[model samples]
Target: MRQSDKKASFIELGKFLSQFSEKGNHLNPEVKNNDRFFDNFVSLIELSQSHNGWFTPEQVYFSVQSWAEALTESNLDQWLSRYDFTNITSKTVGLILAGNIPLVGFHDFLSVLISGHKVLVKTSSNDQKLLPFLAEYLISVTPEIASYITFTDGKLENFDAVIATGSNNTARYFEYYFKDKPSIIRKNRNSVAVLNGKETKEDLVNLGEDIFRYFGLGCRNVSKLFLPKDYDFKLFFEAMYEYGDIIHYEKYANNYDYNKAVFLMSRFELLDNEFMTLKEDTSYASPISSVFYEYYDSADTLKTRLEADKDQLQCIVSNAVITDSIPFGKTQHPELWDYADNVDTLDFLIKI
Candidate 1:
């Protein structure tokens, strides 16, 4: 397919989702009058926030678009002709889902289905609803895909590839269990940001979305901040605090209380207001104890330091100089070209 065709298809899908968003069909019902698919997704994600359950409706949406465009771009039928899909008619792929963040498994789910592989999905209880709902949606679009999709609570063997996501601890389990099979075993990773004083206030506000959206529970959330030493926290906090209404959510408040209590018990100092808290920490992932805001004496030094840790970072939300190849601003204003983990998952699917 031509790139233009690929983009058009994605925009079409985005329009469908936009319609869902507009009608508030995707929000949780108990929150008010929630819709079916998206509302269930949001609730599942909100639940996952407490248990660290993986899969959010938003992440699922992102993954869905990623796969949708990928299939469009690769022209699955044409690409599969090269691999001779007829020869692989009996393959079943097992996906071991993760609950670290919301809807991390949907990408693998899309990969399996779009590639004509029967998927035996072992969903994390934290995210049980949306994938099935999405599978049902796909079935509505093309029922043939339905016969290829199945959800299971138990383990299965003999698959072409196993796409398993878990913590570093369970990674060994995945490797040992799925030994001798093709697999993409993912472990924990976090995203970060580097700020140059030149960033506009408007950009900082959007960066606030990059950080505060989902209350910083997403893999794509900016868990850490790289700032010039002595930089004022006023603007950053102001923009972030604007989203303070999120604190009213009982789930977020619970997390804030647990995290804050832990910090107090540890004797960790924190800066705060009624809405949000801040602190300096070397860790990339925050515990809600406080936002981990780091400082560099200069932008050049910050850039160099980030380079050393580039492999460990997933999406860097930056407003400063970067290797021109790297897209800026959290890539949250995501385009079809942006794939998570900096890896083109669809490329893997077409090859598989």
Candidate 2:
């Protein structure tokens, strides 16, 4: 497709998505009561107990909006102007998706599709509806692209390139298996935060949303913190307590209770509400646990420590208080150009 045609199609896709997402209030019913666009999503989530696919309709609404704006028409044009995409074109790309987080495959799928590639998608049984939903939606907006897409559950062979996301252990498997293929294999990562102690109660509360949303299953959830050395824990915990109801869900309660018990048995120190646990650690990527804050003297010190432990962080969340150069809050909703595992996805696509 020509640039103009691609642009037009993206615009239509955006408009369609915007319209669909506005009906967020109807999503639960559409899935549970009415059976509509999200019926497959409900079924997929139900089939996979390990996957945290119980995202609020409101989250889906905002997420679809974020993606539509970031991936389509003027946004793509602007992004291309900022980054070189001349070399990325129609290629056959294989994707091995991760199920640790919901909708983790969407970014790769969008990248391949937007780059004019024929995608061979291998869905994780843990999270399947997203890919199918996306393909269906894209076909609804641009039927021509449907022929270029294929779903696979087998090994990806004879593909020009591969993009895969998995745990560190699984990453090793991928490296050994697809050694000769051009690939971007994303390993495990977790996001953190730098608390200046100057944040308002509302800011802390918003940060709580970032940490607890998705029950902390997302890569973007703030698993650790760097606070001012003399910061007051009581005030911070008070703000977090406002969100106590978030922990009432069965899955979250199970994780909290199970992990809390394990920590007690292991003689580990824990910070707890009636709902969640805050323990100390370098990294955490699942809802099962979260790391606590250790005070730092200054931003520079925090930066140095973060650099020293850079491998442990996926992104750093602040109200842009430090710098806007890094990925922050809600790690799950990646933009089209956010690039997985800190690698330039488009550049990788171009080479293959």
Candidate 3:
């Protein structure tokens, strides 16, 4: 199929997605393939939590709406215009998606097809429904590309290359198995925030969205905070209080109960506001319903440490406190070009 046709199909898919929201799901009769996909997708979003408790309607709608904004014709054209497609070669690219967040690995799937390569996808058990349903919508939009996408439940075969997302441990296994084939293997990494204690209440409240969205299951969620040596939590906790209703969710409340009890039993120092707990730790990955924090003496010193640990970090959220840091609450709304692990997926696909 032509590149224009490929881009158009995805843009249509985006328009279809634009109709859904946490408040409600609306169908625009003008969007093609709505009859086939619209109502069924609403039911699927409602049923998502049964498949994975973390997939609440609010979070699922946020994910759906974000993609709707991103997959516009202009955004897709701008992202694709940077690469040359004159010498393209088609290959089967295998994708091992992560289910930590809704539609987490959709970027890789989009990249392969846009680059003129077919894709064989292995959806994470945690997220199996959404992508395939969208894939069917794409085929309906452009039936000529029906053979371009496939989802497999068993071992992947007849694929020329692969892209896998998993933990640091599974990365080891992927390295050994796909070592002979060209691949991009992603590992576990967490995002962090740096606070100078001058951030406005609004800034901290937006930061709460970054921390609490997806119930803090996504790698892009801010899991750790770096504060000045003697910074106060009065304002931070107050800002976070806006999301206090999160504890009403049974799954998150259960985690809050269990992790807090463990911390109390261990005699560790903690700051609690009923819904969440804050503990001082040197680690980056914090448990659900809890956030780890550390004190830093100097911004320059923290920059050096972050540079050395960039491989283990996805992003840094700050109000320009650190260079190249993502602003508060924007991590979850990444553009099509914000490749995870700082790797250019289109470039890799074009080469293979």
Question: Which of the numbered candidates is closest to the native, going by highest TM-score?
Answer: 3
- Candidate 1 off by > 4 Å: 1-16, 22-90, 100-102, 324-333, 350-352
Flag clash pairs in model 2: 220-331
Q: How do the residues 1-352 of candidate 3 rate in per-residue lDDT, one tens digit apiece? A: 8889999999999999999998788879899977778889999999999999989988889999999999999999899989998798888999999999899988999999999999999999999999999999999999988889999999899999999999999999999999999999999999999999999999999999999999999888999999997898999999999999999999999999999999999999999999999999999999999999999999999999999999989989999999889999898989899999899999998888
For residues 260-342, write the lDDT of model 2, one tens digit per residue: 89888999887887677777654445345445666677788777777787676677887664575333345555566676557
Q: Each candidate's TM vs. the true structure?
A: 0.76, 0.84, 0.99
**Could you arrange the candidates by TM-score from highest to lowest?**
3, 2, 1
Residue lDDT tens for model 1, 1-352: 1223323433333333443331244432332112334555445434533554223344444544444444443444444344333433446788888654445576667556645567888888766665676566555444455567788876765567778877678989989988888777777666777776666667778877777665666667777777776777777766666577767766667887888778778888887765566668888778642578788887667678777876567677775455532333444444434555666655555555
Error of 1 at 306 (Å): 2.5
lDDT at 13, model 2: 52
lDDT of each: 0.61, 0.68, 0.94
Between candidates 2 and 3, the one scoring higher on TM-score is 3
* Global local distance difference test of model 1: 0.61
